[model samples]
Target: METTAPIVDRWGGGTCPFDAGWKKVMMWSFIITDGLLFAGFLGGYGYARTMATVWPDQSTVFTLPFIAAMTFVLISSSATMASAVWSAQHGQRAVAVRYVWLTLVGAVLFLGMQAYEWTHLIEAGATLSGNPWGDALFGAYFFVTTGFHGSHVLIGAIVLLVLGINLARGRSTTENVEMAGLYWHFVDLVWVFIFTCFYLL
Candidate 1:
């Protein structure tokens, strides 16, 4: 009998020459797939905006300052997530837990800002069907895309919270923290694109 190498070595113990842990490998795979999906969304948004005869000015319709603040908070959270992973890798469990908690706080603030924005927009006559703004599509796409992104943020926060709890209890490893960081970083990166595509240009 002869040993054979598996086509894909997701876990160790196979004949695969290169093997990152399963969690790390899966996280990268997920981020790549998710990135493509966001690309399609942003591409469609760009195409639609381009095809429109009279595209409304994004700045005019959305004048809130909090969204920009939210971006800053999200970017800051990415830093905290990186620190959490680094601390975990170094066996600084307490520091890792604190950093993860900070990241969750950032997420909560971002969600609060989004809720305010949504409420303000709805009060100002923006809806799924239309808006008082020059182009109705602006409101529709803005809500759909932003709401979608918000949902991802919400999910990421919840996952991070769980990872923090597990790490605190010694139920997980540094690899778990690193994997969670990958997902959080991916979500943050996607928001950057979403912000640019849907808000700035």
Candidate 2:
């Protein structure tokens, strides 16, 4: 086997070290790994759908205009998060705080919309065991993936609230705002794939 020496930059920085910060490198790694986990889930869903003799028609299952609104709301939140990070970077603390607040509003609306969807489905006989629509397994995949994503949204909201408080107290840093924005952006991007694959298809 061939071997190569580790590369180091000026000031003796190694390949894994970040010029930005260690937190950013670590955060990127965590987000990438989480992305793979979600991919595994969606891949399983795709395989199951393909191999099954019968799969639920997504249109009849999730046919609602409000779901599109939910997608739009989350996308808008991502933009707000970007603005928050930008403002924080520019030393505009109040603007950053206000944008983060807007992001939180968007997050709350996303969760509320999901709750509304769940209520409608559950009342129509959708359950973990089975749903009235089609394959029983469809409910499993749908709820598991969607619930996982929703949990991330809820956690993001809590993080935003904490960041908001810190910002108000003049304790939050630009790096802190950027880290939160990364996670929010990842959530929004992942939802696009989920929505396109599960709903639009």
The models' CA-based lDDT, in order, is 0.84, 0.89
Model 2: residues with Cα > 4 Å off, grouped in runs: 1-17
Question: Which number leads on TM-score?
Answer: 2
RMSD to the hidden true structure, all candidates: 3.9, 2.7
Considering only N, C-alpha and C atoms within 3 Å, which residue pairs clash in candidate 2? Answer: none
Candidate 1 structure quality by residue, lDDT tens digits, 1-201: 134334344334445444567677778888898789778777777887888777777676776476789899999999999999999989899999999999999988889988988998899898977778666677777787888889989998899889989988999888888988888888899998987877787
Per-residue CA lDDT of model 2 for 18-46, tens digit only, reads 56688888899999999999999899889
Q: Quick one: best lDDT, which candidate? A: 2
